[model samples]
Target: MHVPDGFINTPVSVAAGVAAAAAVAVSLRGARRELDERTAPLAGLVAAFIFAVQMLNFPVAAGTSGHLLGGALAAILVGPYTGVLCVSVVLLMQGILFADGGLTALGVNISVMGVVTVVTAYAIFRGLLKVLPPGRRTVTAAAFAGALLSVPAAATAFTGIYALGGTTDVAIGKVFTAMVGVHVLIGIGEAAITAATVGAVIAVRPDLVHGARGLAAPLKLRVDGRLVDAPAAAAPVPAAARSTRKVWATGLVTALVLAGFVSFYASASPDGLEKVAADKGIDQKAEEHAAAGSPLADYSVKDVDDARLSGGLAGVIGVGATVAVGSGIFWTVRRRRTDEPAAAEPSAA
Candidate 1:
């Protein structure tokens, strides 16, 4: 959830900020191992896709809606470290450009929505993959389960944080109950989206999906009447399939359509956190976003009379900006991975 300003006290907010910064720093290092020439660009596309899908909030309850948190989806598509970075990028863009999440609470949002979700979901996803039968179906199923649980996990984390630093004096039990209960319904939507997206990617380019890596059963060879595990033959790739260009172009187009047009039909009700805050009086101390005056504030373009057009343009801009920033970050990380060897070697022998 996008925690706005004034919800958490200054000290806790700062603590959360430190925690989020630490998480991002660790992820940057871990991402070096995960990012390669092919995956680096796909990582950026994944971020843009998450940004687009987040705009299409589906109705969860009478007054509450939910959207893709993207933790499990990103982790399954790319890797856990990169997934955290992806969500963080989206949150940052939304905060500074769209005035959606509060700048002061950026750390809180990243901790709950980015770090917690990614860690929880990836752990569960990998754990499931360990026990379940190896197959694309199992991978998708595990992704669904991981995504389903991640939302409530995030809610629980937020509840704990609020218990420590909540601005208003609300019953902690009621807040927790309401937050978890509604988010359970929201989790169903998250599960479906994560599963479907993961399934689709696995179907097209399983090679590109980090979670699906090594999913193919090893080649079995019969030697001396005993079947032995053998190295799987490298499958020949056509000149076209080798490049990530097709996948990247397709994903970008899909993101553009979802944000630019499909988001218009998304539910208008407040999301899970907003609804809970309003209902429990937790929002009493909520402050206005610092970027409320920005041209793209509130996901609408300034001076744009047409509601549909304004929102569409804002969404498109958000997708473009997120992709650009995410790609730059990932490209830098990938370069670090490549440069490590040279830096380690002695120069001028």
Candidate 2:
């Protein structure tokens, strides 16, 4: 959920900003180890896709809706570090260009939405994969579970943060219950989207999925009644996986379609956080967004009277801008990945 300004006090907001800054710094370093030629470019696409999907909020309950948080989906498709950066990029774009999330509460949103979600989901995903069967099925299953958990985890983190620095005097226990309860329903949608997206990619180009890397079991042979690992490397990379342009183009097209057209049918009700805040009085002190005067404020292109055209144009612009910013950041990180550990193909992930 995108925390707006005035929800938390100045001190706590500043503290969250510092924490977010440190996490982003560390993630930048970690992403250097995660990104390379092939996967580095996909980072942008992942961010854009997340931005696009988030616009299509599905109804979760009466007067409540939910959208993709993208942490698990991004982490399963890319790496955790890069996934953090991807969500952060989307937050930044939404804050500045769309005036959706507030500039003052940027850190809070990044901390709860980006870092908390990515960390929680990636941990669960890897843990599940370690115990389950090693294949695309395992990856998809882990993704679904990871995504399901991450939403509530993020809501819990917000509750904790609010307990410490909430601007209002509302009962934190009630907020906690409402936030977690509503987000639990949202998590189901998140799980389905994550599993389906990851499954689709794995079906065509499992090699492109960072979480599925080395998932193929090592070859084994029976010699003298003793099973031993084969000396040969694993399976060969399919031609589809080797060529990055086709997949990249396909992802961009899909993102465009989702944001530009499909978003029109998305539920118009408030999201989980907004509903909870309004219900619990946490939004009593909420302040106007600093960028509210921007031309693209509220995700509607300025000077466009047609609701459909304005929203669609704004969505397209958001996707294009997010991809550009995310690609530049990831490309810079990939260039500085010279000191990483050796690998068969650094970019293949």
Residues 277-306, candidate 2, lDDT per residue (tens digit)?
999899999999999989999889999999
lDDT of 1: 0.93
RMSD of 1: 3.5
lDDT of 1 by residue, 261-280 (tens): 99999999999999999988
* Candidate 1 wrong stretches, greater than 4 Å: 218-241
| Range of the 10 consecutive residues with the lowest summed lDDT in candidate 1 | 232-241
TM-score of 1: 0.94
Candidate number with greatest lDDT: 1
Q: What TM-score would every model get versus the actual structure?
A: 0.94, 0.91
* Index of the highest-TM-score prediction: 1
